[model samples]
Target chain A: MTTNHNQIPITYLRPAKGLATLNLKDLWDYRELIYFLTWRDLKVRYKQTVLGFSWVILQPVINMVVFTVLFGQLLKVPTDGIPYPIFSFAALLPWLYFAGSLTRSSTTLVGSANLISKVFFPRMAIPIAGVLSGIVDFVVSLIVLVGMMLFYKIIPTWNLLMLPIFLFLAMLTALGFGLWLSALNVRFRDINHLVPFIIEIWKYATPVIYGATLIPERFRFLLGLNPMTGVVEGFRWAILGSKYVENFDPGPLFIVSITITLVILISGVIFFRNTERTFADII
Target chain B: MTDIAIHVDKLSKKYKLGAMYERQDTLRDFLTSMVRSPFQKRPVSDNQILWALKDISFDIERGSVIGIVGRNGAGKSTLLKVLSRVTDPTSGIGEIRGRVGSLLEVGTGFHPELTGRENIYLNGAILGMKRTEIEKKFDEIVDFSEVAKFIDTPVKRYSSGMYLRLAFAVAAHLEPDILVVDEVLAVGDAEFQRKCLGKMSDVAEQGRTVLFVSHNMSAILRLTTETLVMEKGRIVKRAPSNEAVDFYLSSGFVETGERIWDVDEIPENAAPFSPKALRIINEQGLVVNTIRSTEEMTIEFEYQLDASVTGLRVGFYLMSARGEFIFTTFDTDEPQMYDRFSVREPGLYYSRCKIPADTFNEGRFVVGINASTYRIRRYFQDERAITFNIDPAGAPGMQWPEQRLGPTRPRLNWEIEKK
Candidate 1:
C-alpha cells in the first residue's frame, strides 16, 4: 500500500555497479551511535569488575614481567643497552594495544550478530568502535609506563614526540586486520579460536621482547617482512633514543604496513557488505 | 488513483532450496565429471530445488493498507525478507521509492543486557533514526509502551509482553515512508492487538505505505484496503480483502473418504488404510462443493481394517485453516449401527457418517478423521485419519453475498425475556 508521502531514496540498499563503497555520509549520520556503543563497551567492561581500571595497569605490567624473565634473564637476550624491564615495557605498550584491538575488533561481528542481523546501520561502526575504545586501556597503560620510566630516571629523547604517529600506525594495523578477521569470524568461527594463538606467535616474531638489534644484521631485511617488527623497534627507538640497528629501516616497514592495512580494510568492507545481507537468514 | 508507490515488474525470487549449503558438493560433482574419477557413485539427496517466488508482479499505489494472507510454508516471510533487504533475490528486481522500515519481528535489535533507556536509543539507531530524532520521540515512545517505570532497567528483566510492547511502540512511532510488518501483532494480548490495529490504521490514515501480513482475516477485513493470498510462494489472488478471504476459505479443503484434509490434489497411496478417501456427499451420494448447514450431509471414508479389530472408533474433526479445532464426533457413539464394523474386511472399507443441518457454525471448517482399535484391555491408535472443509450456505441477517466477516460463522442459541 502506498502509505507514506515522503519518499526518501535509501541509496545504501541500491545495487552498485562495482565494489560497494562504505558510504561516508551514512557513517557521519550514525556518529552518535558509534559514541554510545563505544561508551557502552567501556562501561560494561569495567562496571561490575572488582579490579576495575587496575586491570589495565595489570595487563601490561604482567606481560612486561613475563617477557623480561623469558627473553631477558632466561635467554640472556640483549636489550640495546637499555634496562630489560624498560625495554620490554616500551614495546609492550603499543604491541599490547595492537594485539588487544586486533583480537577484540576481529570478533566484533560475531559478538554483535544480534544488532547486525536485526537493524540496518553502518556495520563498520561496531569494529571501529571496538578498536577505538581500546585507546582507554592504551592510555591507562601508558601512564604506568611513564611512571616506571620516571622511577628509572631515564629521560626520553626528542624522538619521543613521534609516539602518537606510531600509536596511530598501530591502530591502523589493528583496524585493518580487525576488519578481515571480524568478517571471517562471522562465517567461520574458527578465526575466533585461532586469534589468541596467532597473537601469541606474533609477539615472539615481532621485536617486542628481544630487541630488533638481536636479529643478526644479515636477516634484518627478511624479518622486516612482519610489519610490526618495525613498529615495535620504532616505538622503542623513538622513546629510548636508541640508534637504528644495522639495516633496520623504518621507511620500508611503514610503507608495507600502511599498504597491507589499506588493502585489508578495503577488502574487509567489501566482504562484510556482501555477506551482511544473509546475516539475518543464517545468523 | 494509480500513484504507484511500489512497482514490482516481473519480480521473482528463486531460492535453490538446498544449493546454498551444497555448493561444495556441486563443485565436487563438476570436478569429478571432468576428471572421470572411478570412485563409487553415491546419489545426493536433498538436491531438489524449488522457486520460492516465481515470476509474479503487481503494483501497489500510495495510501493503501495491503494484507498478505497465506497458509504455512507459503513464502509470506520470504517475500517480506526480500522486500526488507534482509535477504537478496536470486533473480529479478523490485523498485520502490521510499524509505522502508520493517518490523518482521518485534524487538529486532534490542540488547538484553542494555537498559530499556539505552535500547531505545540503540533500536532507533538501528532503524536509521538520528539521535535528535529519537530524543524528540523518546517520551512518546516510552508513554505509548507503558514501560516508563522500568525504562532504566535492563531489558532481560522485562517480561516478554513488555519487551514486545516497547519494541512495537518504537516501530509504530518511526513514521517511516513504508512500514512492513509480519505476524508481529500476534505476540501481544488481545487488547494490545486491537491497539496495534488502531495504530496501523493511523499510519495508513497519514497516507504512508503499509504492508501487513496476518492470519486473522477479521483484522485484515477491518483494516486493510486490499489483500493478497499467497500459496507455495506465488500470489494466487489479489483483490479487496473480503473477496480474497472468500476465495482462500473455499479453495483450502479437499475431500477424502469419511474425513477431509486441507490440501488439493492429494498424493496417491498417501495414508495407510482406514478412511483412505473422503468427500462431502448429499442424500443422493453426489459430491458437491457448497453445503447447506441445515441439510443432511454424508461424510464417506474409504478405509481398511488390517486386523480383526474390536471397539473400532471413528471420529470426525472440524478445524479452521489456522488449525483451531472447531468440534469433533465419533462413529462408535452413533445409534443403530454403532458396533457394526466387528468383522470388517482386509481391503478398503467405506463408512458413511451423517451430520444434521444448521448444527455447525458459519465459517470455514476443515474436516479430519480419527480411528482407533478399541479392545477392553488395550488400544491402538490411528490418529491422523483425514481432513477436508465445510462451507456455509444458509445463514440469514449475516452479510449476504460474502465480504463481511472472518472465515467462519457459527449459529448459537440466544433467548430474551420481557416482563
Candidate 2:
C-alpha cells in the first residue's frame, strides 16, 4: 500500500482571511483521530466514579422526577391527554442530550489545550468529538425512555421512525452552539462561566416540562425561535403520537426551528474555522 | 522538483504580544477596552507586534535530516510549530509534498485515566498514525517501552519513567514521510535518552525528510549533516553541523565573561531568593571568559534573599563543554562554615570558591549555579548558566606539542630515586 513519493499530493498553507473554506476533506482525513478522541472522552468521563454509567440513567430520571413533582403535582401544568410522566420523559430525553452535549462541547477546546497546542489535526475535530461522545449517554438514556413507555402502556407507532430526524436536529443545534462557544472559550474563558447559565436559561425556554399547546396560539412562533423547542416537541409527537396530544401540530414550528438551526450551524462552523487558526497561539 | 519535500516563500508569523499578556481575556475587560479604546489617543505600536518568523524562505530535499539550532526566543520552536501546522503564519505560503508528522511534545493527547494500551492508540493517532498502522506496531511499541506488565494499567498509576518511556515509544514509531521533532530528547533518563536517539537515527536512516530542533549540540551534530542557526527570528547561518555548533556555542551568549539574571528572567516561585550575577575571575581579579589552566581562578555568585532562610546553601556545578559534570561544591562545605551560616539572614550575599592551579584542561567548561535549602525547597538553578574556556599555556604539559585529553589536568609531583 505504499505510494510513490512523487505521487504524494502537496498541501499549501497560507494566511487565512475572512472566512476560511470549510476544509471538509481535511476533516474527513482525520476521522480516526475524531473517533479516538471521542472514545477517550467517553472513557474518561465516568472513570473513578462508583456509579459509572448509572449516572447517565440517574441524571435524567432524577430531573424527570423533580419536574413531575413540581409541575405535574403542584403547579398542575396541563399535558393535553397523555400521562404527565411519559409526556415529560420523552421531552426530557432530547433536552438532556442537547444540554449535556452543549455543555461538554463548549469547553472542549480549552479542555484539550495540550492537544490543540502540541499536535496538528483538523481543529474542528475536538468539538465535534465532544458532541459525538454524548451520543453514548443519549443512547443509554433512550433505553430508559423505552422502558418507561412500556411501563406506561404506550405502544409504538409509524411516527417513531421519524425519531432520528429530530435527534439529528438536536445534535446540530448542540454542535452549532458548541462550535461558537468552544472557539470563544479558547480566547475568552468567560464562555466557560457563561455556558452553565446559558444552558439553565435555555432549558426553561424550551418546551421540556410544559407542552407546546400550553402556549397562546398567536405567540407560538416565539417559542419556535428556540431550536430545542422543535426537538423536544418533535420527540413527544414521534413517540407519544399526535393522536394522544390535544391540539399541537409540529409542522410549522418545525420549519422555523429547522431554518434557525441551519443558520446557527452554518454560521457557527464559519466562525469556528476562522478563529481556529489562532487557537494554538492563544490557547 | 519531485524530490523537494518542503518549500516555502517568504514565510512570516506575526504575534500580537498585547493579546497574549496585556489584554485581559474576559467579557468585562473586553467591553471596557472597547469603551476605553475610543477615548485613548495612543495607537498600536511596533512594541505590540512580534515577528516571530520574518520573511523566512527555505527548501528541504527528500531523504535529508536538517537540524535547527538557536538560543531561547530565537524563533526555532516557532518555525517548527508553523511547519508542523500546529499554528499558522501571518502571511506566507509553505508547501509540503508528503504526509507530515510532528511531535512537538511526547504524549500530546495522553489521558492519565486511560490505560497504557489505550494511550498508545490515542497518542499514536494524535501523532498522525492510522489505527491499522498503530495496531501493526502495537507489539513493537509495548516492547520498546518495556512496560508489558503494566500495559493494561492506567498511566496515572505508572511511574514517571514508565510514562515517559511509553510516550516516547509511541512517538518514535510514527512513520510519516516528513517528520518534525522539537526538543523531545530533553527528557527521560540517560539510557532512555540513548534509546530515543537511536530510534531517531533509525528514522533518519530510512530516508524520510526530517526537521529536528534541539539545544543539545552533541545530538544535533550526531544526527544531522546540515544545520541552520537562528538569531532574533532570522536564519543567521547555515552550514555543516560541526561549523554551526561551533558558531552557536561561541556567539549564542551575548555576554561571555559574566551572566546577569534579569528580573523578568527569574520565575515568581523563586521569590525570597534572587540571583544577581554569576562570574569567573582570574588571579588578577578581572572577570574573564578565557583563563590560563595553571592559574588559580575564582567563581563568584551574587544573590539576595528577601526573607531569612534556614539551611540555605548556594553552590555551583563545574561541567565540561560536552555537558559532563566535573564536580559540585557548596559554599557551606566546611563543618565550621555550615554551623555558622546554618541560618542565613535576609541580605545580599556573595558565595565564592577558588580553583587551585593546574586544574582544568585546554578546553571549554560550563558553570551552573544552584540555591536551595537542602531537602526542603530549591530556590533556583540554571544548569548551563555560563561557559568559559581554559587555555593550556604555562601548564606542565606545555613542553609537549601534542594535545592532551580529558576535562582535567592535575599536576602530580614525581622524583627519580638514584637506586
Candidate 3:
C-alpha cells in the first residue's frame, strides 16, 4: 500500500514543538536500546566487585553515619525531636541517588566519548541510561533505609505510598541538570574538573545531612528554591510523616520546583539535540 | 511514478577556521568598556574561513549507485555525514525516504570490552537496527564474517583483521534502502576487498541505492554507473565511469600544482635509503615534468650516506600501481661502481642515473629504487621509490577489448610456428 506523504498527519511523526528536526518517533522506535544501555550500565558498574550489591547499600549507609555524627552530635542540630540517624538517613536516600546519578551522568558524554565520536544513535540515550541505572542502586539503598526505620521502631506512615512520585521527581531533576552539563563538558574541558566542586557546594544547598527544619521559618520558602530541597523534605515527609513548619507549606513550593525541573528537562533536551549535530566534528 | 528515494536541494557546508566568538563583556568588563568605546575603535581581521563545499547538489534515484571521487580533504566524507544524518549542513536541505546504513569507518562503532555477539546487537542498534531484526540476520552475518566460533569472545581479543571482517559483515548485512560506504574496502586484504566489491555490486544490482567514496579508481570505475569527480571541494566533472576517470587522471598536469599524485609525503611502502625526497627533474635540475616515453630521463636519487661502503648498488624497477614488479636494473649489475667509498662527502647523496630512451612502455609504472651494501640479504630492498606516469607520442595500435591481457604496452618480438 502506498502512503501519501502530504496526507499523513503531521503530529503523528513530527518533532515536538521548539526543536528544529529531532524525530521523537525514531527515539521511541529505538527504545529497546535505551533499556539495554541502562541494563548494561547497571551490570558493568558493580560487576566482579568484593561487595557486589552491598556497595549500593554501603554508599548511603556510610554517608548517613558520618552525617549523623557531624550534624547531630558535634553541631547539636535539632532533628524535630526524632533520633538524628533516622532523620538524616531518610533524606540521604533520595539525595544519594540524585548525587550519584548526577556525577555519572554529567560525565556520560566524556566517558562515552568513544561511542559518541564513532557511533550514530540518539545521543540522549547515554545520559538517559546513566541516570536510569542509578534507580537500581537507589532501590537497593532504599531497602537499607527501610531496615534502619524498623530498627528504630519508626513506622513508615501511609505517606510512604507517595514515595514513587518523589523518587521520580528527583530522577527528573538529576537528568535535567546532567544533560546540560554533559553537553557543555564536551566543549569546555574545564567542566570535567569542576564537577566534584559543584557537587560539594550543591550538597550544602540541599539539606542532606541536617533536617530542612533547621532553615529559619521566614527563609524556609526561599530554601525550596533549590529543587532538591523539596525532594529531600518530600522524602522525609512521606516516610517520617512530618508536617510543613511555621505555616510555610511545601505544597506550593514543591509544585513550583517540579514545574521548574520539567522546564529544565525539556529545554535541556532541545539544547542537547541541537548541539548533538556538531558533536562528532568538534568532539 | 518511479520512486525517488533521496533528494537534495541546494546543499552546502561552510567551515570557519581560526576564529573564536568571544564571550560577551562581563559585568566588570561592561563597566570598563563603557569608557573606552568612544576613544578606541578596533577593526577585526577576517580570519580565512573556507567553505569546503559550496552550492553542490545531486539526487539519487531509488536504486542507482553513485560514486564520489575526490582527493584528500575534498569534503567527500563531510557530504556523506550530512546525508547519513551524522551532521547537519550549514545551509540548504537534503531529504531521504528510507533508513540509511553508513560505514564511515570499519569497526568505528564497535566497543572493545563488549563481546562480538553483544556488539553485533549494540552496533546494529547504533546503526538504527532493531534487536529483533539483527537477531533474524544474526547467523547469516556470523557465517559471512567467519567469526562464528569467536562470537562470544570480547572484541578486544579479536585481531584487527577479524574485527574489520566482522564489522564489515554487519554493515553489509544491514537491509537498508541506501548504503553509504566511505573507503571501507581498504580495511581488508586484497581477496577480501574483491569479495566486498563484488558484494556491493550485487547489492546495487538488487535495486538498492549506494553512495561509495573511495581512492581506488579501478574499483570506482568497475562498480559505479555514474561518477562525480571533485577537486578542491567542487564537482569538476560528472559523467559516465570511464569518461570521468579519464578526465580526472588527465586533469593532473605535469607542471604547476595540478599533479594527480601526492608527491609531498613518502608513500607508506617507499624505500628506506633511496631519498629523503626525490622527484623527476630536468637536466637543469628544476622539478620539470613527468616522464613521457619519448624522452630520455634522469633517475635522480637524493640519499644520506650513513656509513662507509665499498660497493653500494643503487637501482630502480618498474611496477604497476598495484605493486607488481615489472623489471629491474642496478648500478653494480651494469659494472658501474665507485670504489673505496668513504666519508668523502657526508650528507645528501645526489646521483643522477640516466635512463636510455626507448627502453620503457607507456602506462603507469612505480619506481622501486633501492640501495644495498654490495650483496646484503635483500633486506635493503626499497619497494617504492616513486610512481610516474608514462605517455608516448602516438597511440599504439591495439584493440580495446583485450584490455586486461597485461598492464604494460611493451613491444615484444614474436614468432609463430606452423606444423
TM-score of chain B only, all predictions? 0.63, 0.82, 0.67
lDDT of 1: 0.71
How many angstroms is residue A136 displaced in model 2 relative to the true structure, after the best TM-score fit? Answer: 0.6
Going through the candidates in order, their DockQ values are 0.18, 0.66, 0.16
Fnat by candidate, in order = 0.26, 0.84, 0.18
- Candidate 2: give the clashing pairs: none
Off by over 4 Å in 3: A1-23, A47-54, A110-120, A242-249, B19-47, B252-362, B365-387, B390-419
* TM-score top scorer: 2
Full ranking by DockQ = 2, 1, 3
How well does candidate 2 score on lDDT at residue A71? 94
Lowest summed lDDT window (length 10), candidate 1 chain A: A10-19
Evaluated at residue B305, the lDDT of candidate 3 is 48
User: How good is model 3 by TM-score?
Assistant: 0.76
Model 3's alpha-carbon lDDT is 0.71
Model 3 chain A: lowest-lDDT 10 consecutive positions: A8-17
Tens digits of per-residue lDDT for model 1, B291-329: 666567787766665556656666666666444556667
lDDT of 2 by residue, B1-419 (tens): 35788998888988777675444678787778878885776466987777878888888888899999876567888898888888988888999888888865666788999999999999988888999999999999999999999999999899878988999889888887888888888656789989988988899899888899986777888899999999878898988889988887777674557988865446455889999988999999999999999899999999999999999999988888766778989999999999999999999999999999899999898887889987567798766678999999988878889888888999989998997
Give the C-alpha miss distance for residue B102 in model 2, angstroms: 1.4
